[model samples]
Target: MKNYWYRFKHYPFYQHKWFRISLASLLLSVFFFLITISNVYTETYSIERFTEAKETIRSPLSIENEKETERERRAAIQSVEDRYEISTEITQERVGYVNELFEAIDKIDEEENDSGQSGDDGNTVSDKEKAQDLQQMISPEISDALQREDLIQLITASPNHRSLGKELLTTSLYDVMNDGVTTENMQTGIDNIKEKLQYSSLDASLKEVLYLISEFAVVENSFYDAEKTVEAQKHASSNVEPVMIRAGEIIVTEGQTITNEIYEELKLVGLLSDDRNVYPLVGLILLILLIGAMISYEMNNYAAKRELDAGKIASIILISVLMVAVMKVTSLFTGSVNQLFFIVPAATGAMLLKILLDERLALVLSMMYAILASLIFNSEIPGSLNMEAGIFILFSQLAGIAFLVNLKDRMAILKAGIGITLVHILTVLLFLFLSFEKYSMADVFTYMGFGAVAAFLSTVLTIGLLPFFETGLGILSDTKLLTLSNPNHPLLRKILIEAPGTYHHSVMVANLSESACEAIGANGLLARVAAYYHDLGKTEKAHYFIENQMGITNPHDMLQPEQSAGIIINHPYAGGKLLKKHKLPKEIIHITEQHHGTSLLKYFYFKAKEQNKYVKEADYRYPGPLPKTQEGAIVCICDSVEAAVRSLKEPTKEKIAEIVSSIINDKLMDGQLNDSPLTFKELEKIRQAVCEALNGIFHSRIQYPTNQEVKEAN
Candidate 1:
């Protein structure tokens, strides 16, 4: 619970109300679409059933019940008459049942006829034999008619009469209303029955027997009609409630209403719902999931490829949110945004990735940007999916990212922007043929125009926004560092003028540091550039340092041990502050601050200790947060090694190696090398590089000596 609360407070998305709002809105939209789709299908089917019910209620049998309700006093007399009429109704019921049997036989014949199985084959049965087989299924009711083939022939001869006979079976109940058997007829029938009748009424059991016969006849007729209707519409495939279509069947087109065939396909794929509007929402959600996965993959790749600062990472997330908002707002006005909305994020992220991180990460970020663009373009309420424009923008970004893969200069980024325009035009025309199937040159041109505008906008925005992040956020992008590291820059030229020895030393150190860094898998360019600025503080009092003093009198000769120690320790800290003021990379600032990690000012420490018993060894130490990065540690080791090796009057490969190794070992033993990732193996490699560098720096030379050296040699 505590961890959850901490995340809620600290995590950016959890803390941001807008993220929550967007998430909730997505879920609500899906739910609303589900309800709408379900209701559409449900209401349509409900209306269908209601119409059927009204038709059923309009039958003639329904009117008979109304008439029967109107005569209550005559009901008793009518009941006696009704029995005689009901007795006659039983005979009609028998006839209706027999008619149903013939209707079933006729339907089977019709089916066989359509299928080309109506006794066309030599071995197949004739229509006479098929009638015999069907008569067995509808026995007793159809038996009497079957005994006379002449009666079947008569029924078959009148084709309309056969159909009319089937309709009469179901409509026999209508005779109750249409014929209207009168009370006069009923009374005359009952009086004639009295002559033979001793009992006042017929047996109750017998009346129930007659009613059962009538009920069976009605049910048999309904079944026969339902079966015939199903058989007639067999080609319509209406028998089964859920229909199935075979593969390769065309279900619907762009202008067609979703047909039963299409609906069945959707059902087969489990895409159709009790509600219908969910398809668009489903498409949107799928895009969201895809975009999210791509973003995560890119983020992971960035973390793997380069070391990202927390502040820079936050800036990236901020840009993503801003781009998402732009997509939403622009799509509302027109379909202009489309997948190109992702280009804004991609272009900005690519510039940052290339400058602040690496070029490979920029390509990954561009693809991720395309995914986000698709989601933004396809969003039901806010998406702007211009199919043609979206395809153009996607390839445009791909071309842009591909063109600028290893770009280091502003001109390269600009050239890539123009290249994106051409790529966009070609891709739009290609996708027109591939995706849309029809190509219109004018439409393609219009899409290309939009794409070019989008790419140009991205370039302009990238250029404008890059500096703000570089300066305000303290990020040292490649472009920013390149600009600052120019040799003609005022600070570098000033260093060259006032402290030529230190300037020369910095240049040599830059080469040594860069090579060593690359050897150990560290940032080589950063290490090299940092080496140049690490000793800028020596410019404040150039003559005080021995290298810059040269033939001039050294001021250190007059200074006390404590004063000289203070001067030595203060330079690195001063350099760090100066670089910070100029807004250099923190990595560079760290190299300056940590280059001289609390090592003794040996000359001053020994002198002070001999002269004054109270002069502590601690006071002679340089202020330090020891090297915290591999590059910083490399600079630290390189700094000491350079000065120690240069101090040798005559150098050898063995002496150079020993001196470099001793300096590195001393720092390691003193715990100054604890933070950086360099291991014993890397340190050995560095020792070798230093030895190789020293051999080249002080190569073997013949003694072409001064006058004293020449006289001694002769």
Candidate 2:
């Protein structure tokens, strides 16, 4: 039963990540299709003319009837009377002409008096002569209107009367023409002049003459302002907003005949028949394909070559699908409150991926989740995408990613969550400010609250789900490494109790390997954990290893070189078995087994060769699969370098650097590090890091004088 269970757990078919990814994609697509299918299933109507509705229908969206609105605006603009300006200059000029005529008449009378013409006699200038003379002085048209008697009265009138007449005529013309006066209001202006003159002491005939002069002075001053009128009409039209049919508002009731207006509204809301429109489905498929391609490309490029196995792929797919599911489920409650979409825990996936995988892959997956969110949470516009939600998710995920970079502890997830919340708040405010809609404080706060909740929930869910994915998927997250690095771990505790010297040595090696691996961009935590367990098998025979022998005589001295080499060779394999028994991760087991590599045990090999001329080099060599990964290779170099440097009588920085370089060069010559992915540049960096660490560990210390020596010197 145990064997069957183990086999079932490791079954390839059940663990095939490609198939899991495909299934996850299909499920996501189905969910998206279910949510958005309503946009495609529009109802068809056949009514062409207006008809009475069987039931009342509301607009599906707010839209403007541009033609009707424009018509109303134009009518309003046209209702405003044409504006005009009064020309005071014309009034002044006409008054001056009348004065000149009077002056000319006075001049003619003076000349007739000087010539000794008697008044009221035939010899005096006749009224006909005066009239003929006035004709030449004024315009011929005005001269024709004046009668001989009128001319005679004007010539005989006093200067005060002429001045009074001129004042009344000019004042009435100025009053009437100063306002907007068109040809349509000319007679009205004339009547107003007559009324004003009637109250005067002037004769009725004189008032009538003043009225005629006022009428002639009146000219059209107001003109049509077509540009200003058109501009006003446009302003009014623009102020008329497009009527919107909000989401969930009814368009046409069932069994109701659709009118042209109703049909257009339905079409605007994407409710009209669109049986031939496969564009949405096609677009959805294309988007899915694009996401899949990105995932494939990113995984191929970012993950370690051997680490690009089914398990990691499964983990990636699981994280993505879980995030998408959270978004979809949250969308179900979105209703009219689209901001509820912010409560979907968008940062959780990026945080999980960053913890379980590489940060680059996490960033890529964050983008994918953001894009999917935009598509899924667009409930307000059925067929349209919600770009604001997409941007919000993008920044939220990025915040988590940024916070998780170089993270050292599991509790940092909470800090990252807080960061994500802040980012979400900022993102929500930015989008709100960008929108044309007016949002109340309550609405803004509500949306911001949702964003905060989303960020907090991401932290909560990531913390809650972390252990499960790490344990279930056998993923060696940094948190898991930290846990294993703890001194309280059973294996670590066992090593400490059974072989204290070995435990101390392992700790020193761990420090060296961690720094070295980190310098080369490798998994430093994994290297540290592996270093702690690398010598666990030494507990079974603590006295055989020199470090744990403490002051005891060397047991290897009594044993043959072959026997000592065999014992040394078996320790790595034995440690690997013990790790398996403890159910530790395979990566740790592999690192422990490969740290010794296949390098020849020079001490044993040379000693045996001196004793027996036929001693074989292979007999003194360790059985190894070499260092297959950079972390494992780093452990191998640190393990040897730590032991070598600890044996120095009085170590200096130079001595430590020499020994570290020697050990690394020997490993390279022996082909032990050939299988590792470390480049030449990375190896140089690792060498420098190892030297720096060893220098710190074995730096020269000041020696204080003994009490007796100090007293003697004094």
Candidate 3:
């Protein structure tokens, strides 16, 4: 039952990370939904027109007020004055009549003179007869308009006076009709020509003739143009700007009676409609689900790699919740004017994720956080996003992630913080300069100060939170591994003092393990740290292990074969227990425990079999749950190879390579690496890396002549 329970507890299905990861995603989604609900939720007012004693109300959305826009358009169309066009045809017809009348009088006078015969008695013609002839020669319309006496006077006048009168009448006629004459002003047009003729240099009789003729030339020329008037009205309507009830615009004032227009505006902006709330809530849910999907996707990749554990899951949830909470809280104080969101430590969560978890996860969640900030800082207005805040946060997050390099170095976060600060300042400047609104020097300094503070705070938070994950939760980060690998660590120092030979051996194993792990794309730091502490069990009985029994008789030589085998097999577990008690990270402890599988203690088991008729082989083997990770598998292979190669009296490159291959083959045959998921290609790479490292350590040294021999030769 106990063995069954052990297998049950370690079952892959039981420990599968998908369930916990899904829960984390759901928790974050719910948190996002709850925090951002108010931003998208709408509250309808129960106020009526002419009602007083209400708080100041603002628009919850931006929409064109269609009714108001239509009203304004109508007003613009009404404001356009009617347009009129003058007709040139009317002016030309009137002027032609005056010319024809004068030319007919001249032709009649010329005909009478040239004939020198008239009245059938061959005598000079009477003026009346001449007028009668002139009248006949003139156009019917012109003759009908004039009396015969007026024509007789014009025919009796001297040709030069008639010429002058003709000139005067035509000039006044053209001048009066060229300007448009409406029906109301037609009489005025005729009177204007009559007045000009009255003041002319002609005699009274000629002036009278000229006056009568001028009246015919003046008529209405201006006309109302319908197409032109309609076009002008349409242009005026098109130019009218749409009346919009902008988001956050004031709709009604406190203690002021609500007017019909104000109430309609409130309804238009969705401040007085409950149905408007539903759509935004639905949109928010979709956004939250998308964020959840991104998180689940990243977590699935980690699980596929067998790297996602409960601590990492918890870390993702904790950091994301904390970041969103901080942004939401900061948003409470932010406004369209002050925008205190600039002071939020937006990069803190990214820095922590990059340090304690995966960089890709950090980046993905950063985008989610930025989008959340945009919504949260939108002043609870539907369809409004604080894009400046979102853009600034995104730039800050990218800068933080991009600058975080050399994960082993403690100063990486600081360098990243500096980069984030610069990016934040530039982003703030980008918004400021690109904006149409003016900002003062004080505003510039204030925002820049906010950016710097945010960077400093992010750095401080990351540094502060790292130990919480590393020490409190036992989740090993690269920085934490670096710390443990230091010789000055208490556990490391203890190993060095109590087991000097074992310490040297562990150090060599660590070097080889790191190289091999790196070659195969495994966690090199984890492999190296695991190697450093794998033989920590030896400190309990340093002389028992061959490496620690320096300059002494072998303790195994004095012990019974089974007893010796038992002692050797217990060390890996003993070291595991010590690591657990020290509260070291689980990765280091796991690697330490699994580095040696339940492979047989061949020398001791064989010796015991020789002495007895039957010796149980199982009793001489180490108790192991075999290495289940690449780092553990690499450490296991390199540990044996390092020790075996070091024992060679004349270690050569060929010998080191052969030893590496043999140990790997032994591990493979015993199925020690069955669970590590190593491909044949990766195994070959690891073999090459271990052989190269070992050969470098065991290379031939140069031999120099002694000091005495050199002096004698000189």
Provide the TM-score for each candidate, comma-separated: 0.58, 0.69, 0.86
**Model 1 per-residue lDDT at 419:** 73
Candidate 2 lDDT by residue in tens digits, 114-185: 776444555666767876787687765456656666776776666677668878877776777676567788
TM-score of 3: 0.86
Question: lDDT score, residue 483, model 1?
Answer: 79
lDDT of 3 by residue, 1-714 (tens): 564466567876536465677888999999899999989886788777788927998878888999989999999999997777888887777777778887777777667666765445577778888778877877887888889999887887788888887777777777766767888888988888788778877788888877777666677888889999999999999999998887888888899888888877776766774435577888999999998998999899877675788888888888998999999899888887897888899888888888887788889989989999999999988888989889888888888899988888888898888988898899888888999999999999999999999999988998998899777765789998898898999889989999999899999999998998889878898889989999998888888988888799998888999888878888888888999899888888888888887778888988999998588988888788898899999989888987899889999888888888999999999989987878899999999998888878888999799999999999
Query: Which parts of model 3 are misplaced by more than 4 Å?
Result: 1-15, 78-87, 106-131, 149-233, 275-277, 432-442, 551-553, 557-560, 611-616, 703-714
Which candidate number would show the highest TM-score if scored against the true structure? 3
Candidate with best lDDT: 3
Give me the displacement of residue 48 in model 2, in angstroms.
6.6
- The regions of model 1 sitting more than 4 angstroms off are 1-235, 238-310, 333-346, 359-364, 379-398, 405-407, 612-615, 681-696, 699-714
lDDT of model 3, residue 707: 98
Worst 10 residues of 3 by lDDT: 268-277
Q: Native-vs-model 1 lDDT?
A: 0.60
**Cα error of candidate 2 at position 456, Å:** 4.3
Q: Give the higher-lDDT candidate: 1 or 2.
A: 2
lDDT of 1 by residue, 512-619 (tens): 887787777777777888889889988888888887988888788899989988888889988888887876778788889998877778788899988997888889
Q: For candidate 1, which ten residues in a row score worst on lDDT?
A: 54-63
After TM-score superposition, the amount by which residue 566's alpha carbon in candidate 2 deviates from its true location, in angstroms, is 6.6
